[model samples]
Target: MLFDTHVHLNARQFFEDRDAVIQRAFDAGVSYMVVVGFDRETIPLAIEIAEQNETIYAAVGWHPVDAVDMTAEDLDWVEELAAHPKVVAIGEMGLDYHWDKSPKAIQKEVFRKQIRLAKKVNMPITIHNREATSDIIEILQQEDAKEVGGIMHCYNDAVDYVQACLDMNFYISLGGPVTFKNATMPKEVAASVPLDRLLVETDAPFLAPHPNRGKRNEPAYVKLVAEKIAELREMAFEEISEITTENAFTLFGIKRS
Candidate 1:
């Protein structure tokens, strides 16, 4: 069985055949999925999906890119949303300098506020760091994020950064990029990260693995990621699947059926 630790099923791209796509994932052995919401608009949709599907869970937060326009009321709304029964984590939050959608200062402030909310609610956070490793690490340290440990979704950082997150008790989640021919860094992190600290995800409808690259990704495609990790760490496919699934469950506090 597989547990996709991070996904965005609420995205508009899946509106056409979301039900069918979710069914496909289950049929393909994807036992559970943690659907992440990046903004206020997506949070309710995520909760709605989770409430309808037994295997779907929700993670809510404002993405760094979306933090530019967020106000005090937006933060208050997120705190209220975090109380949802199906909301498993407070995230898809962190720094993303690649797009520069929001100023660095605003992004950091938003990230810190969410961290505090996670602490208040006693829930883990799903982090999204991109091209802003130092700032991300600095803010996480400043906020003392270890209290509510979480996963670094779609991790694409250097060994040092991966180790830093590990030190802070964050799970390192590998996505489709691990299967890319030139993805040397993520491959190294995958091989080096302790089995207990590792998790796998598709980040679906995006980051499709090799052979499936350039195509729309889906939860079922997470098998390709497991296959790649198996090859990288020289482990059996079942072992990789089992360990990562357990790691994901441990992090999200979800029980496997």
Candidate 2:
């Protein structure tokens, strides 16, 4: 069994066959999946998907890009929703300097707020750092995020930072980028990061692995990611699946049959 720890099931690309896509995921051995809500519209939809599917779960929060528009009431609302049985974590939220859609100050404020929210709720967080590793690390340290450590979703950063992220008690997750033939950093991270702390995700409707690159990704293709990691580590495919699934359960406090 495998756990696709991150996916955007609320995206429109899966609109035509969302249920079919989910069935394919289960058939492909994805025993559990975390459907992440990155913005306003997708948040409710993510929870809705989780509500209807036994294997699916929801992680809700405002993306950094939408930080400026997010409100205190919104944070309160998210905290309230966090109590839902299907809600696992409090993010897909972190700094995104790449797009610069929101001011750095607002992004930091929102990120810190969500982190604190997760702490208050005693839930782990799913971080989304894009070209903001330094600040992200600094903030995690400053905020003392180790209280309820979470995942570094789709991690693609300097190898040295892996230790730092782990030090802060976070697991490193690799998505479709790990399966990219030419993706050097992800490959290196996969080979070096502790197997016990590693996780796999497709970030579905986004970064599909090698052969399906540039096409819509889904949880079903997460096997490709597991296979690639197994190859990189020279370990058995099933071993990687079991370890990563355990890592997902540990981080999210989930129990699966």
Candidate 3:
């Protein structure tokens, strides 16, 4: 069984055939998934989806891209949702410098708040990093995010930064980018990150794996990401799947039965 550690099944892209897409993921041997919800609309939907699906879980937070829009009430709401039985983590929150929708200062402040929230709730957080890797790392360190170890979701950064994330008790998650032809960094990260500290995701409805590169991504395609990682690490596909699934369970505090 495979665990897709990050997926946006809550996104509108799956609105029409969400259930069907979930079934396909199961059929593809993806036994577990975490639907990350970054804003108001997707947050509630994430919890709702998790409530309906036994093997699926949810993460709630404000997206860095929309940092300016997240109010104190929104933060309060996310904290309340964190108490939900199906809610396993506190973020998809971090810096996204690629977009100017929210200024860097606001994004950092928002990211810091979410990290503090995660630490308070004693739950892990998932990071959404773009070109703002350095700032994200600095804030994570400043916030002492290591107290509540989390995931660097779909980590596409260089190998040099991998050690810092690991030092902060963060797991490096490889996604569809690792399988892309011209993507060298993710490939390097895939090969170098420790197996136990490794995870895989699709970030679905986005970043579909190679061969399906330009199409809509889904949890079903996580197997392709796993397959590529296995190839990169020179390990058996089943081994990589099992280890990563176990790693995810450990990180998310999921007591697998």
Candidate 4:
């Protein structure tokens, strides 16, 4: 079995065939998944999806790219949802310098607020970093985020930053990029991250793996990610699947069912 630790079944792209996509994931041996919701529209849908499926869960947070739009009420709403039984973490939140829709300072402020919220609730966080690895690491350290460990979702940075994340109690999650022929950094990180602190995800409707690279990604494709990691580490595919599933369970505080 495999745990697709990060996914976005709530995204609009899946609206037409969400159920089928989910069925495919299970058919492909995906035992568990966490649907991440970063804004008002997606947050409720994420929890809704989780509520309908026993093994699916949700993560709620604000996206850094749209940092300018997050209001106090938004944070309050996210906090309220944090109490939901199926909601497991506090983010898909972090810095995203790739887009300039939101100023970097505002992004940092929103990121910090979400981290603080996670700590207040004693829940782990799932970060969304883009071209802001150093700032993300520095902020995590400054906030003492190790108190409630989190995930560096779809981490695509250099191995040099892995220790910084590990030191701050963050697991490194590799997505479709690891299977890309030219994605050297993710491959390096995949082979080097401590097995116990590694995870797999698809970030579906996005970054699909090699053979399916240009297509709409889905949770079912996380197996390809595990296969790539297993090949990179010279380990069996089943072993990678098992280890990553266990790692996801540990991080999200989910017990085997």
TM-score for each of the candidates? 0.97, 0.98, 0.99, 0.99
Residues 181-235 of candidate 2: C-alpha lDDT, one tens digit per residue: 7899999999999988999999999999989999999999999999999999999
* Candidate 2, position 255, lDDT: 83
Segments of candidate 4 deviating more than 4 angstroms: none
How many pairs in model 3 have backbone atoms within 3 A of each other, for residues 3 or more apart or on separate chains, i.e. clashes? 0
lDDT (Cα atoms) of all candidates against the true structure: 0.90, 0.93, 0.94, 0.96
* lDDT (tens digit, per residue) of candidate 4 on 179-200: 9999999999999999999999
The candidate scoring highest on lDDT is 4
Writing each residue's lDDT as its tens digit, candidate 3 over 1-257 gives 99999999999899999999999999999999999999988999999999999999999999999999999999999999999999999988999988999998899999999999999999999999999889889999999999998999999988999999999999999999999999999999999899999999999999999999999999999999999999998999999999999999999999885
Report how far off residue 102 is in candidate 2 (Å): 0.4
Clash count list over all predictions: 0, 0, 0, 0
lDDT sort, best first: 4, 3, 2, 1
Worst 10 residues of 2 by lDDT: 248-257
Model 2 whole-model lDDT (C-alpha atoms): 0.93
TM-score winner, 2 or 3: 3
Q: Which ten residues in a row have the lowest lDDT in candidate 4?
A: 133-142
